[model samples]
Target: MAKSITQEFVKGLWDEIPPFRLVLGLCPVLAVTKSVENGLGMGMAVVFVLVCSNMLVSLLRNIIPSKVRIACFIVIIATFVIVVELLMQAYTYSLFLKLGIFIPLIVVNCVVLGRAEAFAYKNGVVASIADGLGICVGFTLSLTALGALREVFGSGTFLGMSVFGPSFQPFTFMVEAPGAFVCLGLMLCMMNLAGNK
Candidate 1:
């Protein structure tokens, strides 16, 4: 059966969510999510790259040879990633510094490449756009949630504003590598339990 455009768009939000459901892009998810600002920045970059690449891939699906499809996808994805990196550096130098190498690394993110290979190449422009938007929104939500959790518990602040009172002691661990894993694990567990129920 054919799926409606809305279904295609909606599925990526939760059903096939990139990080939490599909678990495709963990590197950026875990790395830049120490703060909501960093997570949102990285998420937007990924969205721009993903949507642009997906659209291009869908547009050229017929012309690109199957044997070199992967290379074509990488080139398309890299172009958008570069654009994102330049834009970030120009407008948000602090975020650009915070994101560091992860910004450029967006070119190699599996989420972008995977969508190109698995969905965009086989779908129409509209559907590809929907897929890209849906996936990126899902990714952004996941990153923001994780970042907020870490920021609140680890730093006693939310997006740099203190959330707890003066006497409230920060956990500190929630901002560390181990904390990221633990938080992600617990979140995943909750997601699983919710889905099962």
Candidate 2:
């Protein structure tokens, strides 16, 4: 009952999407998605960490003992998260500040560690890479969509450029904490409805 590499990769796009379909990694999805730029930045950092961690975990799956597997996986994931943090600070200082602690919190993101334990550890390196990439793509898309929706409604802008006319008043609620929950809930409902059809 083995799957082809293509199938493995494709599933993460929708069937196994991180936040929407899989319901993993919601903290950052709700926290830093006030703007599309922030969302994309966070998502890319996650993609880098997820892919790197998955590859390392798959590569060392045999050497790591069962009792210490989770510990080993954390170490591997933390290494990549630190790399992401330093790189972001060096290149994208503004975004690095905007994202703040959430960047470091990527170390505990269920999506990265979950994949390391669930998919990467059990699969070949190629399959693990595909899974990581697919999941990251799905996650990035979700974050961007949410960020765009919130940004447009909340500020009447997309990525900081005004989209609405001068007469249009922004919906401040969309960018607030309550708005995050509301937007996410409505989106989840839509997803569920579409999935049932």
Candidate 3:
């Protein structure tokens, strides 16, 4: 049975949330999530690339030869990745620099490539778009949440505004690599617990 467009979109928010549920795209989820700004910026760039790439791949699916489909899909994804990179560099140079190589790494991100190959290449344009939006939004939300958790405990701020008293002692560990891992693990555990309910 085929899913409705709404179902496709809704599943991504929870059932198939890329980082949390699917456990895909952990590199950016772990690396750039030190602050909400980095996570959100990375997420927005991915939203643009994934949605655009999915649309293009779906539109060109029939014409793309089966033998060259993967290559063709990479080319499609890479084009959008480049567009995202250029746009990021121009408008948000500082954030772009902070994200660094991770921005370009979206071309190879399994989330984008997997959707293109698995969904977009086999689905209608509208369904593909829905899938892209749903998955990207879920990813953005996950990143932002993780970033917020880290930022608040690690830095005592949310997007740079202090959320606690001046005397509050930041955990300090929450902003480091180990802290990211611990936070992600705790989140994963919590999500599992919630899903079980």
Q: In candidate 1, what are the lDDT values of residues 1-197, reduced to their tens digit?
A: 19878998899987999988888889999999999999998999998999999999999999999999999899999898889888988999999999999999998789999999999999999999999999999999999999999999999999899998899899999999999999999999999998988
Question: Can you tell me which runs of candidate 2 are displaced by over 4 Å?
Answer: none
Which pairs clash in model 1?
A: none
Total backbone collisions for each predicted model: 0, 0, 0
Best model number under lDDT: 3
The lDDT of model 3 is 0.95
lDDT of 3 by residue, 1-197 (tens): 27899999999999999998998889999999999999999999999999999999999999999999999989998999999999989999999999999999998899999999889999999999999999999999999999999999999999999999799999999999999999999999999999998
Steric clash count of candidate 3: 0
Residues 52-103, model 2: lDDT tens digits: 9999999998999989999999999999999999999999999999999999
The parts of candidate 1 lying over 4 Å away from their true place are none
